[model samples]
Target: MKNLKGKVALVTGATRGIGKGIAIGLGEAGATVYITGRTLEPSDENISGTLLETQQAVIDAGGVCIPVQVDHSDDEQVRLLFERIETEQKGQLDILVNNVFSGVKEIGNAFGQPFWKHDPSLWDAINNVGLRSHYIASVYAARLMNKRQQGLICTISSWGGLSYIFGAAYGVGKAACDRLASDMAVELKPDNITSVSLWPGIVGTEEMFRFSEKWKTEDEKEPQNSTMRDYYNWETPLFTGRVIAALADQQNTMNLTGKVQIIAELAQRYNIVDENGNRPVSLRSLRFIVPSAIPALKKYPWLIPDLKIPWFVLQWTMLQSPKI
Candidate 1:
């Protein structure tokens, strides 16, 4: 891996989930990471991770970290955050990871609801946090990176974004984000600031753990007996974190600029694996399978199908697609 000892990174939503993992991973590789989040701390419940935890992890990994609290939904707050980075870091920024998100419950609940029955507020929340936040942050980062003439900006999107994933609002927001990255790449490529959107395939975060527990059946009792749960647990947010680290350390990262990358692809390139160092499974090819299986996938009532293409074809097609 290339050494990024003096580089600087900013990760929004760094307080939890994949964002935190990426931030720590970058820090581990010697990048000075700035971690941001909406809420600093929750007084109630088991909120085990915080931006502070991310910072500590970086420190433990022999890297530097700074935690900042900001609500990406607020334009003014985001502006201030960028300004602080500019002034404090002297206008030097290398990696910008946009991973802020919220309103999960509202969107998830809208899965089966008809379009007309959907709440506008839920859409608003998802758009603000999911779409607008990414755009605004990218705009600001592009401005800064353009001046410096080099940077890497990665937006966090999801497989569900490209197709129907129960929650149309959230999925569409992510889809838009993917396009945003491509558009940004077109504009920023000349400036040497590579912009890309990427997804962490089937991450097993705390929230996912909770969700899987709920997704299981009390009467089925298979979760209690089988090791199926372990499959999903194969990769954690940390896996993607290390991938970001490798990306930051890449010597010719600009060569692959302006694309929507998936975690599985990166893992393969860098030989990154699950916590146990095993090559975790990736759903990159599912996009193809999903489109063709739409009827069956929906009728069978498996996880929401997010693509219209067949899984095998999707993977092959993506690989053959022209890279800009």
Candidate 2:
């Protein structure tokens, strides 16, 4: 459990949900965790949780916790955060989990709407904190990490980046995030710093639970209605956190630099399971997903052979292929 005992990490936007889970996972691994969020104290806010609450959770998980109230939108505040981390941890920042984003609400509100109908500000709403914030934080982390010539920068991205989900703003922002991690890794490789874009499939976060409300009373015949019934078969927020901890603990981390890591696959690589002690299905795994998604299929788990559409295969299109 103390595999990460001497490690120091920072998780941004960790007041609740995936951020909170990451902190806890790191804490459980015995890492000194610094958590940041706009909400400092417990509030009646609909989104719920706070930096203080997350701090306690980290401590309870057996990891040191430092809570900072920060608005990632403010570059100055972000700069101060890294400066403080450097000062306190003595220039030893082992991990940076870029988990902040402000556009979840906007995406939910305009889910079915087209790009033209959405306000232009939607782009700013999603990418400003999501993509831009990640870039800014990485710059600072790399600076400190380069001093020691080692560190990990993990961006929380999504499958939407590949195909499409939420809307243009969300997908564009995610795709950019993926690119940002890869490009940063390319430059930071010489500095011995690793940057990886992480994709957590169907996280059962607080916000996602709220999003699942509409499916509760839907028609049995509704299209894709049973996909996520209040996070059914979804990975818990802590799932990715565990995978991240393993990534940091691994001696071969540099081998994975500049790559987009799927949490489910990483979980398998690390032999980790969700809080429920079940392996979360990969987005591309037909064998596991079928049984996990439908109750009736659970009886015949082995009927579907293990099969996955690899990332290259999933994205390889006519345009990407060599025109014969």
Candidate 3:
């Protein structure tokens, strides 16, 4: 494993999915991981990942993980979370991953609509979780990292940020986040702080599995269960997790600063595979395109229409869907 033995790392949205995977990956490599989320309970639909489970996973992998609950959308809460980290962990933060997200309201909306017709609250929600939260967390992380004069800050971004998708708020939110990473990298470079945006190709998460189950019930014709072929095709959260571990182990890691790297490319460079030990390929490479699906969309072929407006939105929704 990468020699993060005495290092400390914080991962937002670490209760489950990609965040959880990365947290566990870091832990497996011997780092003390702080898992942050909105809440600890499963009733909080906005926060489905459980901190306890993440901590246990890390311990089982022979490392330490501390679960901390915080709503990044709230400035005070964000500050407090970092304060606790400083007090409990104390000046040992080596890696910071901003993977927190809460945009459930946009689950089934039509992306072709104009910004004026969209829900105002959804825009605020997206901006809060997707963009602003990243900034707040990064600001605090940079402050601490500057003191050490060396650290890595990786922000999870999507391909949508690179292309035009739909809805001003969603698209703009990702675009701004991409810039945030780049701008932070530029200013913090002299401090030996590496900041960059990394993309998770197409993760099949718990949300994806739930969406698939619900979609299957709505329509019997749609195959809710994945065949072995489908299983090998999509990106798994672990693939990105392993890629992150590799990045954390890089010799000239700063050379990648400020760049928005695709997870597919990273996997190739590092040879990351899924839990099954098979390489996970991107949809485009597999000659497939997923949609911004609802719980029932998978059962009905009609719901599989192309969602090309803001690429990240579709990726987010697809990844958020329950992955069986």
Candidate 4:
């Protein structure tokens, strides 16, 4: 990827996981990155990482890092965050990564649970931070990008948006994220700003590794019951970050605006590899999933038939059911 020297970037939820990885990647490429998260100190024990940790990682990677403690769920905090950036950077924001997400902690192992069985409050957990926060951040980002008439807004979405991977709330939130990028691109296009949703296939973050280890332990008791094997081929968070940085550096990025891109395919095109120096497989290839014409189909549901299949059959075939 081309160097991001002299660029200014804002990465939300940078305390841990994919957000942290992306912040580090941008910093390594020589961008001054402002990272935001709820966790202020590395000593905070509630989460696996803190903003201070990510800030240090970015600085260690040879980029200037500004750590901010902002809860994305709070509209006031989000607004203030942008104000600070605008004042400090003089309206020169180059990249805005909408990576903040919540509610996963509440989901636990309820990936396959029916919607009714889960807590109703889970909807707020997912949408409030993931969907609503993205929109709020984009509003401020658009203003900053419009000032310079060039910028990239990337939302870290998932395959779950295209197909059912987890339960209803997760899928809904991700799907909204995809749509958010698409719609935002429409308005931002005239200003030379691009908004895109990126889907990473099975990232091996610290949280995911913990989940994998538990599944591995369960697999010992019943060999066929575990799904941990698939995670072995997972991509590192930095891989997606590389893709984002490359996209921002591309001159023709406007052409890709409003598209939902798969990280593995982008990696192949850009010659990107994970931390282990291996190409990650696309989730579409693994599950025989294909990108759906969601917006178009939503307006015309009569185009396809909706069939209710047994859960076991759905799992065995890896075929996603129609959303209708």
TM-score for each candidate, following the candidate numbering: 0.82, 0.92, 0.78, 0.84
Task: Please report, in order, the local distance difference test score of every candidate based on alpha carbons.
Answer: 0.74, 0.85, 0.72, 0.79
Cα lDDT tens digits for candidate 4, 88-202: 9998999999999876676665654688987788889778888899999999999998989999999989867756656788888999999999999999999999999999877
Instruction: Please estimate how well model 2 matches the true structure, expressed as its whole-model Cα lDDT.
Output: 0.85
Best by lDDT: 2
Clashing pairs for model 4 are none
lDDT string for model 3 (1-324, tens) is 646788899999887788988987888878888989866766636555678878888899878988888888788988888888888877667899988877644643533357788668868777788688888999999888888898999998875565444356766788788899999999999999999898775577876555444444444433323322143245667677778877887767888999887676677777766677866444433222432223333334344442223445645654565222
Off by over 4 Å in 4: 44-46, 109-112, 213-227, 286-324
Instruction: Count clashing residue pairs in model 3.
Output: 17
Model 3 whole-model lDDT (C-alpha atoms): 0.72
The candidates, ranked best first by TM-score, are 2, 4, 1, 3
Model 2, 1-324: lDDT tens digits are 799999999999999999999999999999999999998996567548889999998888888999999999999999999999999999999999999988888877886679889789989998998899999999899899999988999999988778666777888899899999999989999988889999999888877877677555656553235665424458899999999998999986889998899999899889999888988767778755566556567556568765787767777741263110
Off by over 4 Å in 3: 42-47, 109-116, 164-167, 210-232, 282-324
> In angstroms, how far off is 54's CA in candidate 3?
1.8
Error of 3 at 27 (Å): 1.2
RMSD to true structure for each model, in Å: 6.9, 3.5, 7.4, 8.5
lDDT score for residue 160 of model 4: 76
Clashes of each: 8, 0, 17, 0
Candidate ranking (lDDT, best to worst): 2, 4, 1, 3
